[model samples]
Target: MDSSLVMIGLTNVLSFNNIACILGGTLLGLFVGAMPGLSATMALALLLPLTFSFDPATGLSMLASLYVGASYGGSIAAILLRTPGTPSAAATVLDGFPLSQQGRAGEALGVSLFASFFGGLMSGIALLTAAPLLGTLVLEFGPVELFAIAVLGITIIGSLAQGSVISGLLSGGLGLLLSTVGMDLTTGTPRMTFDQINLFGGIDFTVALIGLFSVPQALTLIENSHQGGKVASRITDRLMPRWSTIKQLMPNILRSSGIGIVVGLIPGTGGDTASWFAYNEAKRFAKDKSRFGKGEVAGVAAPEAANNAVVGGALIPTIALGIPGSSSTAILLGALMVQGILPGPNLLTDYGDVTYTLIWAVILANIALLVVGLAFTKMSVSVTKIPDGFIACAILTLCIIGAFAINNSLFDVGLMLGFGLFGYWMSKAGVSPAPMVIGLILGPVMETSFQQSMLIGNDSFGVFLESPIATVLLILALLSILQATPFFRWLRVPFKRRLKPD
Candidate 1:
């Protein structure tokens, strides 16, 4: 809130060098996000080390731009092919593909691009206003409260699971176990390292991320190479929406952006959840609900708006609480640490200029997205025409390079390959990788905080329950767990039946 710091931040972000970084990052993000089997998180992880050479503000700005661009980019594939470029675009496929099939691909792309820009713009404004205030409030949080928050985050594993709650829990447990493979932080003792010196530091997260996200995708593409054809129908209509259509979708866009912001503020929820919630809300409020899945412009707008808004919303918790709101923000948190910057309450206090610069960069990224998305819509559609063999090889090569670049060690590459196979098997079993990634990211935070809380509480576990904040967080975690279970739905069914008075 310091006037001088704000001015300095604005000046730094607007500089030629930083603007170039933002532009380059946004273009790269669009390419990655428009490709099926690629995700923003993976792209950021792969490109994180490249930012190490830049100044803190410039580096962070680049990552922020990538995040913003990727959030909008996913809609390209969701509309063109039946495949969503990123998981966040899953809801987009419902209406996006239908519209494409009906030869309304251009209209679908226009609505998606415009809605994404509006959502991101709104969320950027929210981030500008909300993060500093949230940072001030969380400054009061103790170790026990932080530990409780971590637990609450972990509970979201059930919501992230692609299969049953049990599967999600198991995957989360596996990640936690993997996290413990390195030397014990409390003591110098090596916990799970089979005396291998390389294992002393544990598996590098970047390596694991590349393996889990990229490798399986490459394998899938290779396996499905036989069914080679154009990815989508030709887009032949106007690339921009009519003013009347835009006016009709304005309400849905606004409503969905609000939904995205709220959901993104909650730890562990991401764009995927926001998009689905927005789509459902749009359907519930529509005058003609039957038009929803069959090429409705509102349907495309609802999800695109929500997913893009999540980029800014997710950054709120990451910047303010040092708690990642989603997997993508988790990678962003890691990037901050890599650059010797710590997130949380002190972020705005110690690095106020840099923080504000990142926020401004997000706004700029959204503006760039609108221009680039509209200009490249026709050209981007041709990307899906590339052969699967070429795509698979390219991804495989990047995975190898990214994994090795993490530590300049072949051992890391081996670990990446091992995890890649494990991830592929997990996918085959219908288990979600998201819960595992969350567990890996949060495991150390939870352990260290709990340990510190125990020391503060004279080694008594009861201290966590004694704190009001911790108690509330723990209760929320419990509720999240219960809500994911079948028993809770069954219990609610009877109550709903009684209320209906049938």
Candidate 2:
């Protein structure tokens, strides 16, 4: 890396425009993420078209900050309303809402925000140190290894459906089906277009993301608008996490962050899965598991740290191997490609200075998130006070604009509305959209790699088993599925009983 170029890049990011974008993006993400039905995926999709016109560095810097902030922001409502703003926050509501009920809402929110910042910072540092090493390692992968990585990604979908891993697998299968709608990349043959011109390109992932995340949220908001009350009583003081609290949470935070960084290094696991896994593990490891769902501060701390840490974690492969760890970063990767920047080994060799600058940008962006997030924390809470009528109109407008903006195609606008109604129905049925989003993000990667691996092996029936990496991944996937079943819990009872007595 050229020291001068790296210095220049830092100078550029520190400029007023880039700094402002970082703050602005954080604020926007916080607001969207705090809303009960809005999600990080939806916010990213809505903002994607707008970033097209920005400097690649500026655009990504903003999105990166938003990604970090939004993940944290969801914990706010999870604490206050018993409604998680993002699926990653679902575990937060286990204990966060109870804290609010006890008139400790401010304390909970403060701890959440502070923990979020810590996790994000730690992850950023990890990204800076780890991305290059992992990226280079990934370069050794062939189709078999890549296919194994994709299957591991699908395992994350199971975590979202904790009690019924089969349902999660079904959701993933559906996503693979959807990915096949477009023309085949390898053969140029259309398999599932249904003879429609629009279907030739397949459903836009952004459109699906927007609808899957946002529309259901809008319906929930409409239903909940009438049942209103101040969800908090006296706000607690000492918004910052005290040293004692930090000490108590340190072990869990470290554990969860390790989970996040490792999961994030995988090609498709991303932050959402990291958050879920961290939340579950934190619960399992707690000395008093009973305290977990009843307002344990550690519950908020663990996932918050894990998810944000994923930001830096995901960036490792993105910077090193040129593959994205999450959907949001995948979109950013597309933006990089549009700007004619190749991401991968050559990037570090040829433009290590620029890469360092990008790492610096990540650090700067997170600092901005912490500062702006703390400053405007109270204001973000007030957004729920807006009338449902206004939210309906605003969301509808954004839906229209977001859809049309993607490809300047009115057909996409219709697609958004159609999926919007579909999402509404799905929500009413109690099917969380988080699984769907996970499935969608992992689907294409899994399919392409699966097909490619099969081809490389000359379509031999036993090729997957022949590959050690593939066999290990298959075992992990099976284990993940088994862990999600009731049989596993049933099997654990005798082991616990044996440990307890004669």
Candidate 3:
């Protein structure tokens, strides 16, 4: 990165408006994450439409702060209710609730808070260092290479998704099909508009995100409202852990943070995977594994640290290569495109002021996480008190208003509701909507790049094969998909023999 760009970023983040947004976002995230059902992704999706009114840097910084805060806040419900507030907090419940039952709630909360801060801080530093280097390397890519990158993204995300690879790929395909809804760019004729003027420009990505994430979540919360006993535990002891305890766990925290950063670099994996991976590593490294689920502080520290670390780790590819590292980053990338900032390698140079500000915001947001988390960790239980039925109603109302607010079009609102129902159905079918959203985001880029590459290659199909980067990426995409196939074991037979000989 350039010194000038760093200076520009410093100024952008230091502004009063941006600082307020970051702090406010952090508070909101804490509240949302303390609830048992809401996720950082859903919070981000619901709040995305509101960001359009602000400067891109401020809005993005706010969202980044929210991401950092929510990652930590999820640990609260895990400790108190024995239920994870978010999927990423699932591992924390293994030890966190045990501590609460043993009257060490404060100790567990303190460990979680400190671990989250340390992990997020380290990941932010890694993001600051890694994204620019990767950006420079990718700046050489042409339309052919960009198209290849898109193909690689789609395949990798699909293959690694939580369900069957076929389902993932189908979701991605559906998103690509939906992305073609607007008028054709090359020809003035509409492609999939179905004679609706609202579809002329295209489906609003923000509208779709709000509907897909928020509505289903609200509906689920309503369905599960019959369950009770969500009383929050009170923090009676001092919130901070002893310095000796911190020293003892520093190694575990550092190792888990590293694990988080690496896991987050992958496109399909998210904090949930990183947290579980870290928790297992902690157990494996412990002298007495039997203590892991019995109110062990290391168990609490590992998962919280790893999950919060994912914030900065996931942003690297999103900022550097325009390929979202996780679902949360996918929304952030969508917000960028919605704000008229094109996604690609030049994010460091062409949009340095905004991009660099976002980087700085992640670092600062971690710091803010430490301060806000310490002060309000106990007080956040108030948020959990709100009834699920009320939350569902609020979510539905907000989704409708936000969808309409995008273009003041009732058709968009109806479309959002349609996607909401579709999202709910997908959840029942065990399909993740993230891959679909990613495909939707990447579709236009892939199409435009392919068309441009063809034009550059004199309308020859051989153009795709001309670039080495494109060729390598296309091969990787093929390998990614093939690895999920039934014949992959057969394909690995030769490698197995070679490894055995070695």
Say which candidate scores most in TM-score. Answer: 3
- Give lDDT for model 1: 0.84
Residue pairs with clashing backbones, model 3: none
lDDT of 2 by residue, 65-112 (tens): 788788888887788778777777887888788888887787787778
Worst lDDT run of 10 residues, candidate 2, spans: 229-238
Please give the ranking of all candidate structures by TM-score, highest first, separated by commas.
3, 1, 2
279-348 per-residue lDDT for model 3 (tens digits): 9999999999999888999999999999998888989988888888888898998889978987776688
Where model 1 places Cα greater than 4 Å from the true spot, the runs are 1-8, 98-103, 288-291, 342-346
Error of 2 at 180 (Å): 1.3
TM-score, model 1 to reference: 0.92
Question: What C-alpha lDDT, on a 0 to 100 scale, does residue 445 get in candidate 2?
Answer: 57
Q: TM-score of each candidate?
A: 0.92, 0.77, 0.97
lDDT string for model 1 (310-359, tens) is: 98998897777666777788777777767766544567778788888888
- Counting clashing residue pairs in each candidate, in order, gives 0, 2, 0
| Model 2 score (lDDT) | 0.72
